[model samples]
Target: MNKISYIRWFNEIGIDDVPLVGGKNASLGEMYQNLTAEGVRVPNGFAVTAEAYCSVLEYNNAWQSLHAALDGLDPDNIRDLQARGEKARAIVYGCQLPDDLQVEILQGYAQLKREYGETISLAVRSSATAEDSPEASFAGQNDTYLNIASDDALLDGYKRCLASNFTDRSIHYKYDNHFDYYKVYISVVVMKMVRSDIGASGVMFSLDTETGFKDVVFINAAHGLGENVVQGTIDPDSFYAHKPSFVMGYRAVLKRRLGSKEKKMIFTNTLNTGNIAVEYTKNIDTSSEERSHYCITDSDVMVLTDYAIKVENHYSNKAGSYKPMDMEWAKDGLDGQLYMVQARPETVSSQKKGNILEIYHLKERSVVLLRGRAVGTKIGAGKARIINDVKHLKDFQPGEVLVADTTTPDWEPVMKIAAAIVTSRGGRTCHAAIVSRELGIPAIVGTENTNEVIKNGQAITISCAEGETGTVYDGLLGFEIQQTDLSQLGHPKTKIMMNLGNPDQAFSFASLPLDGIGLARMEFIINPTPRESPRFSHGEESGKLVLT
Candidate 1:
């Protein structure tokens, strides 16, 4: 196909044309043409194009041998997997580029230099067919070379990115996702990498992650590129931006921790902070210096929300549409303009009504001993286990009842499987209460001294929804039936559960019927650093539950 036709094809088909355009080239063409037309500002750059990528792949056919080898290999064998993946990468990188492709790549770089000028360096990023879809979000699954000084570097960077398609993490991700090995083709899109003033850029979701509310756009930004923010290397500032702009609620930034611009990670350093260091751990370039500007402002939010609505409206008009959207947007620091990065139909909209639960805005989950009457309701059947602290959480198996003194934020995994929770001391606002309400699990909390009564892995019962008079039954005591009493008067379908911290309270549910919990609290899923549980003062064993 002619160059213009290939570019046009990419704009129309996106990743669907990896065989013709390659991943990166297709994405660049799509972003440059379609996204730009839609008012998303992607820094100007040129794609060497996927047609070039396929020519190289076909020249070597390294993919065929790699595919055959991968077919028989067990995914559980990490050593063998890593070795094969490395070999595949070596084979791809070793292939010689055809003269025509090489000239095209250099010509593309020249075009970039011509368009964006020589004043700024370009970022050569990889875009593989299997990556960056709304379904998988294979972000950072491929290599991206930044600050390329010249054309030779760009060519070398492209080869390296092709090799990166076989990186251990990349391979594992593809294997787990069951991507078609033969069909997982890649294309490269070389872009004029933005010299961000904020040192780093990060993603903002147009909804609350915890509560799934569409009214708020959650922004997580850090001192450097979004990789650090998403990876949790440093605490990023979180902003709650209200949709369609609100005078006050539109911008609320939470500065958790600031990162050091000068203190970068070095493998040769004598001082070991034990943190995984990336090559970009060099001193912050002046290009990304933090500006005095607020990460987000009310005026900026109004502009972004307006753009978000426009994009949303435009996409809704597309055929085969189902529900509302969840989208990603990026902002150019210099222009201070918002850009639509991606758009996808919201998945939760298709789920059953039971799984459709409202998300909440929470500061954080905490550990607290509480009390409650156990209502006689059990949902899923499971064994029982009494856990005292975070370190012991894994000991409880899936489909087991967890009785704990108090749980911390680390116990999310165990809660996913636990039958129910029964605590000795907390109330409705406690961590146990909040989680139980969210997971649709049955729980009983605030039953004073209840932890002293339950044993680890012993059979027990809990009834969370019976309010104050719920009873616990040793065996499955009643029929499973969905209830709507927990939901508010207007929102009758809303489900509410219980959170608990103690095990002994299981006996409180020896009678009475109740519905399942909305969440199972697991605050201390796993404690990395051991800390003493909050202790009772002298003569405080019988202290009033409401100390405040």
Candidate 2:
């Protein structure tokens, strides 16, 4: 594959191949090819091609230079690590652009111009081989230079991108992923950009974060480029859209502010709508307000929705082909276009019948507590010990009981290696319970104070199959699968689920035929650190209080 020509790489792999395609190219291919097939209007753009990147790195013998700079620095020493990363980047930027790769890039840009129009402003971005992952979003890890003014800027932007591999965040991620210094590669894509008078954009997910319900489409739309939404920097307009109904069930925000064309950066005279002509602005940092505008109209929204569904379906189909996917997507509001940004293996277990065999009788409602949530069901038995970070998670030896405030996505890897799972926040619909049940392990959620009551590495027993009343034995008491039909659980129509913090939770719930989730909290979705909630937030915040 390394020896293959750049053009061939673009032809065969395309954007669908996330691992090898590189993120920017994959998104372009997804939007321009697949999503367009379903009739969505994506902003026009062309990928500079990953092969071009490889050719540049290989031809320049740049790997050795970069390697020499970052060769033996301790990955954990963030300060020294950053300084070395900067040094490597300086070397990459200092090198001259190769003639042939430059020519190819220019040709792609020229082709885009012929198609989208010569004056089209473009968004030049870095799509490295190692970025945009299930475990890592690669948020701002690479450079995405928006609103390029001329051809010269585009070329420079590409160089800037190559240099960005050395950015602090990118360096840290590479270290965390254990990517080899010499092996890490990057791709550049110079896309025909969307120029909007009113900039509005944001991210949307197929599942609800507050609840694990798979039926709802959770959206966070803001006035600007959607950066605020991804970074959790702004209180964007939040909505819950029901999938089956395709209707907005709920929407909330403190305020709504759109971007304006009056700013000096206005590059286009086109107006998307009379009412939405202004771009939205939100206070991102203390300095000047961050601005964004939405160009997708109501009709465009419908078109984008259809496109989003197709992109999602494509991902689902791929995952189904191998094993179905749990996915994420974002849209370019400027063009009423949707982009398939991420996809991952679905791990939540199938739900089981509320059979007698699935049920376990509990000794009493003697449970530990942790961080709390608004709602959820309880399972398991023990004095819950709240774990905070990867260090704390690693501290657990085999057979030592574990508990948390709430689970998050990052916690997935560690959960696979834990003795037991307990939380104070999630309900039957939560990620923790779902994954636990799938793993066929004991998990108790909504067990408030599991953190306060249990000490680190304390011995305990747990049972999710246990009835509403369960006993907490200081020693290992039992392991059981308490099951119940959703119909009998009060909401016969809705799927009952527990919230989860990590990917392992999903796998743990793999055996049950759960109608999917009613909620999957993205927060508490990762492994907890020592400082946060003591890993018992669910217990203290949402679980029942038991006085022995």
Q: Model 2, residue 375: displacement in angstroms? A: 14
Question: What lDDT does candidate 1 reach at residue 472?
Answer: 44
Regions more than 4 Å wrong, model 2: 1-20, 133-136, 247-305, 321-548
Each candidate's lDDT (Cα)?
A: 0.50, 0.51
True-vs-predicted CA distance for residue 405, candidate 1, Å: 27
Per-residue lDDT of 272-376 in model 2, one digit per residue for the tens? 464221122223221135424333334434433444445567765754642222333444435545554433333432122233223344444434333322111
TM-score (C-alpha) between model 2 and the true structure: 0.56
Position 522, candidate 2: lDDT = 37
lDDT of 1: 0.50
Top candidate, metric TM-score: 1
